[model samples]
Target: MTDHVDVLIIGAGLSGIGAAAHLTRELPRTSYVVLEAREVSGGTWDLFRYPGVRSDSDMFTMGYRFRPWRHEEALGSGERILEYLRDTAREYDVERRIRYSHRVIRVSWDSDTSLWTVEADHHGEAVTYTAGLVWSCRGYYDYERGHEPEFAGAEEFAGEIVHPQHWPDDLDWTGRDVVVIGSGATAVTLVPAMAEDAAHVTMLQRSPSYILSLPRRDPFAVRARRWLPAGLAHRVVRWKSILVTAVFYRLSRRRPETVRRMVRKQNVALLPEGYDVETHFTPRYDPWDQRMCFVPNADLFTSLRSGDAEVVTSTIERFDADGVVLTGGRHLHADVIVTATGLTLSPFGGIELEVDGEKVDPASLMTYRALMLGGVPNFVFTIGYTNASWTLKVGLVCEYLVRLLEHMGRHGYAVVEPRLPEGGMATRPLLDFGAGYVRRALDRLPKQGPRVPWVTSTAYGDDVRLLRRGPVADRHLVFTARAPRAPVAAEAAAGR
Candidate 1:
């Protein structure tokens, strides 16, 4: 038996919900379904239950277009984000479309019908569905597991070890000496939160990451947003945030040294007077080379200044009975070890596609606007901005996708897939700014060069123009429509 739908969306996360909302609203006549691996929505926000899980970016730009964020501060907690997602799902009536505990394991293209056959497990039972279009918004974060470094004697450690992704709910860390590994945003966030409860939290990082501490509230905009209408308030705050971020990104891209100098000055002022800025602040890579860390409430620096937390630049050789042993042969005692290492990104879960039993190597497949998988028509994947707000980029993608679907329906195309006819370059990893997850997936992922739409830039204005200006054209996409063929019986009868 086969279940049929106009569209089958994978993952009920931010991107998935966003896309679904657009489709349902614009194309109300189309039938659609969402398959979620987990039981609940909110994706990353719902999954990660760490101590200080919050948005690194401001909420003014991060939140959805239809919803205006009314939080106390721009940076919000995981619970707050989950609430927003839940509200969005409820408001759109998308909750009913979600099929939980249904993990999609295989997707096969049936060219004759111009549809994708998706197979998944539904409560330990096998089920299959066919749809004219398939969109994956599973997100980059490994839904299965986070990447934890295999350290020698990790299991031998007598102390409690935890990864930020799956933090214990009932952790009692009062007066415990905690050690956090990794220098990403997670490490910075966990340190400040742990400092309040832990006896002393020491951040054991191999290399120093450049951190910019900003106040939680946007002082000027907060007043306006409170008094003015939500629409006006959102526009004001969004523009203000976008302009400031764009300027800084432009400055960093053009004059790297200027931004570097600014970072040095900020670190010097934030840290103790006469302290070595190079020791705890300076990063080896260029500014924005890897993601720049953001600290809300100025908590991270305050923790350091108060001596509640100490940043140690050293490598973990192995885990001893009670603590971590540095590569330099120094052992630091830790009552709890928190590995805030990084994430693991699986592009379509490294799935291998076969067309008519012919293997389709995704590395060779071209990406249309860094979203769609080549050879898949009427499908759009929502991958957001690397530098700016995630929703800002994805919202535009959703809008474009809706318009594309409408156009396809009007044109009576049974199928539409982006074809890279030129095949000028092989697929490479999209972002190579040394973000740990990106670097890890470099060899196995799609390659993107610096080009219009194909290459992602920090400028959202450019993206808006590219997405909304006019219909995008590429030779690679092939459109197929059904046509009636003459009956074979007529020809045979005439010949006889």
Candidate 2:
């Protein structure tokens, strides 16, 4: 017999657990089941076991609004984050709802029944499930593989090459020279982390990414927790973080030069005097163009200043047996090479979607309020903001979805689909990020319209007003009542 639920949530990660918690607390009547492909509940936290793996965004905003983070640290380690997710799952009893090691492969929506049929591989067995609504909380990154760029003579390299996504547990490069490729968050994080044990760690990048220094621990959070209730204190800190980050983002866009100088000055203050801040720390683009890297307590700078780590901003010509040969003909020796390259973006967890026997192409669909897709009914996908903390937008998204569902139930609507006007709407790429991972998978992703409700803004304030407080009934959304089923006898006669 196929399992059935009112809502089928895919991926028991941060978003998934948060969504489930919301459903349990807000929509208590809704029956839901969470399907996680991995054995563990924490998705990204469990997958990435690299050294110094931590959240780039602060925990106050990144954390779920309902569950107040009691930790003193703003930047939490991967293990600590995993513990948080597990604790959340246990506290909300969401752990019981999650079916681990179940990878959903396909989801098909039936218009007549107004239900979705999901197929998944559960512990090497194919299992089927039906649900009134399908909620995809799976994040954008591909968990199976990271974005590994091809390097000439990479195979000729004698040393071990590793990717941060699948970091080897047994591998140790202590007292050895290491070279980390890529200038993204992973590279920056790895350099200082690995430098502590390794003799020397070199961050090899084609270009620099805007990096900022932040305190590992939040003094405000610590003080607030002592005086106020944990929940209230969390909210206070969260809002404060939101306001500051929002202002910074706005300033970066409005006054790029001013923000650039400020960021450069901050970096210079952390590093040794006369250090090549322009060459290594300075990015070609303005701040907020790409997501900025945050190094807690100026750890990366500390490592650099101590001569344990260094940065090399140049293109790689080829990988030699000893190390890498730069375009300028400089050869760096390395004992281990860590490919801290970017991630591969996969929408809807790379699951095949069909609507009434018609294969749905994600690229053909336009995003509706950045949650649901146009022409898709009874489905919602949670995607976080690129500019701000991920959970801030995701929390709003979950709240909005619950509101929409309640509205639909009261109206006796079986399906809700956003339909564009008769005239074609001008469309653009969904994400405005210039990151390599985003650019690599832009063609396969969904599109966004030029107008409101269709275009997704990274600004959390705008999203809160639109998604959290906006009306459920909109001009573009089309709701349909469920059609009556045929008689059993008639169906048998037709089959005979």
Each prediction's RMSD to truth:
6.1, 4.2
Q: If scored against the real structure, what TM-score would every candidate get?
A: 0.93, 0.96
lDDT (tens digit, per residue) of candidate 1 on 341-448: 998888775545556557666666556777776666556677777777788887888877777777777787777877654646544566656788888876656656
* Ten-residue stretch with the least lDDT total in model 2: 487-496
Question: What shift in Å separates residue 149 of candidate 2 from its native position after superposition?
Answer: 0.7
Estimate the TM-score for candidate 2.
0.96
lDDT of 2 by residue, 1-496 (tens): 5766778899999899999999988987777888899998898999999999999999998888988877888998998889999999988878888888899999999888888899999888998888888999998989999999899999999999999999999989999999999888889899999999999999998889999999999888888889988778888999999999999999999999999999899999988999999899899898888999999999999999999999999999999899999998999999999998889998888899999999999988999999889999988999998998889989999999999989988988878998888986999999998888899999989999998989988999898889899897899999998555412222111111
User: What pairs collide in candidate 2?
Assistant: none
The CA lDDT at 440 in model 2 is: 94
In candidate 1, which residue ranges exceed 4 Å CA deviation?
Answer: 350-352, 426-428, 473-476, 482-496
Instruction: Quote the lDDT for 403 in model 1.
Output: 73
Instruction: Tell me the lDDT of model 1 at 299.
Output: 90
User: Relative to the true structure, how large is the alpha-carbon lDDT of every model?
Assistant: 0.79, 0.89
